[model samples]
Target: MKAISYSRYGGPEVLEYGDLREPKVGPDSVLVKVRAAAVNPVDWKAREGYLDPVLDAVFPVVPGWDVAGVVVGLGASVTEYAVGDEVIGYVREDFLSRGTFAEYVGAPVRTLARKPRNLTWEEAAGLPLTGLTAYQVLVKALRVQRGETVLVHAAAGGVGSIAVQLARHLGARVIGTANERNHDYVRSLGGEPVTYGEGLAERVRGLAPEGVDAAFDTIGGDTLKVSAQLLVPEGRLVSIADGDVVSYGGRYSFVRPDADDLTRLAELAEQGVVSVHVFETFPLERAADAYRRNEEGGTRGKIVVTVAWDTAGPDA
Candidate 1:
């Protein structure tokens, strides 16, 4: 099968488009005929060895986590889906080898969910990882409540965009930090936008003088620190970007692949309670360019890689 892979950790330059052997499906996994994959910062970070401390990289690594595809074959022990089922998944494992940036992927049932029928392939591919991050952090980690004022950093980015919408649905008033250009975009997502940097704390205070009831920090470093200070007494805080959040009396969250959670997100998507924005997309062979675009940052949403499958074969 054709896939994007790298033998050694480096920049996007390390990525190669070539043929790799088909994945062997386990009893709990299914073989998905890949339609589209989304590029997350983690994809490029993992490519550069930044996540080496946690995730083991099996060399010749195929790097991608979010996918929307169709089930071509079911595992012997699987009863949840049929051969023609369309699905979306956060197709990650403890190790990196076989991944979603390929013509096909062996995705475990634990990470798969029926795709939202209303979404385009690229939008469905963009939803899994980022949507889960926002859902888990808001619903579980932050325990955001109705009528609370919550602040989200990087409001126009993938996770923050979803966070704003979900929080509003949960009855919370959202305050999001974004550039001047994205203020209207954030407002469209149901957030009151505040310009980041310098007087960020003052700007947030201008919106909620009593201080926010919860804060979701997507940018680490100084932004995380500012979020810590913006909270009301005992206000909740969580960070997916930095583990140091624990030091500020906040929790550090890492999104895990859970079929139940993914299903809920899909339901919400189909119901129009949430949506994904595709900032851009590239063909599978130009996946390296997608990585480069993601690394450049400031994208409003996900960058996707699409596979042009042929009835002829994998290479075609």
Candidate 2:
């Protein structure tokens, strides 16, 4: 099978496209015929070896977190899905050491959810990582209620795009930060668009005047620092990026692969309660290029990698 991998962690240039053996199923895993996968900040960060502290990677690593695919075979112990179900999932971070950047990847049955019938694989591919992150942050971490004002930094981003829609759907008035170029796109996602760099706090004050009730902080550094000060007395601040803000305010690492959450997100996608926007798509052979684009930033939504597969063969 063709897959993207790096023998040593360094830059995107280290990624190589070549043939490798297909993964065998574990007792609780499903062998998925990869269709589409999305790139996240973690993909590039892992490629450059930045997450060595939290996740240990053995090289010849394939780094991707979001996967949309069809089940070609099932583990002996698995019963949630059959041999021909279509699904989408957040493959565990450790699994990315040999990830969805391949024609075939194995996902545990617990992580896989039926892909929404309304979306193409490309769109479904874009949802798992970002959609789940946004859902968990708003519905669980902050517990944002209707009529409250919520600020979402990097609002045009993969996670933020979904976050904005979910916040609005939950009845919060969402104030999103993006550059002038992405303001229209952010607004379409149901957020009030605002320029992000410098004087961001003042802009929020001018709009809401009473400060925000809560914030979903995706950008670290100055953004997180500033958001902390903007929170109301009992407001929440949750971040996905690495930083020390937990010592100062509300914080939670994204909730991983909760079957119930994935199921709910799938239903929302089908119902059009929210959408995952895909700004770019690449073939597995161009995995290096995909990571480079994600690192450049300013993207309005998720970037996906299409893993093209041939006809099914005998199962391993």
- lDDT tens digits by residue: candidate 2, 71-149: 9888999989988899999887443475888888888877778999999899999998888899998999899999999
RMSD score of candidate 2 (Å): 1.4
Candidate 1 stretches greater than 4 Å from native:
312-316
Q: What does the lDDT read for residue 200 in candidate 2?
A: 88
Q: How close is candidate 1 to the true structure, as a TM-score?
A: 0.98
Top-TM-score candidate index: 1
Worst 10 residues of 2 by lDDT: 307-316
RMSD, one per candidate, in order: 1.2, 1.4
Q: List, residue by residue over 174-194, the lDDT tens digit for candidate 1.
A: 999999999999988999999
Q: Would you give me the overall lDDT of model 1? A: 0.94
Best candidate (score: lDDT):
1
lDDT of each: 0.94, 0.86
How far does residue 8 in candidate 1 sit from its true spot (Å)? 0.1
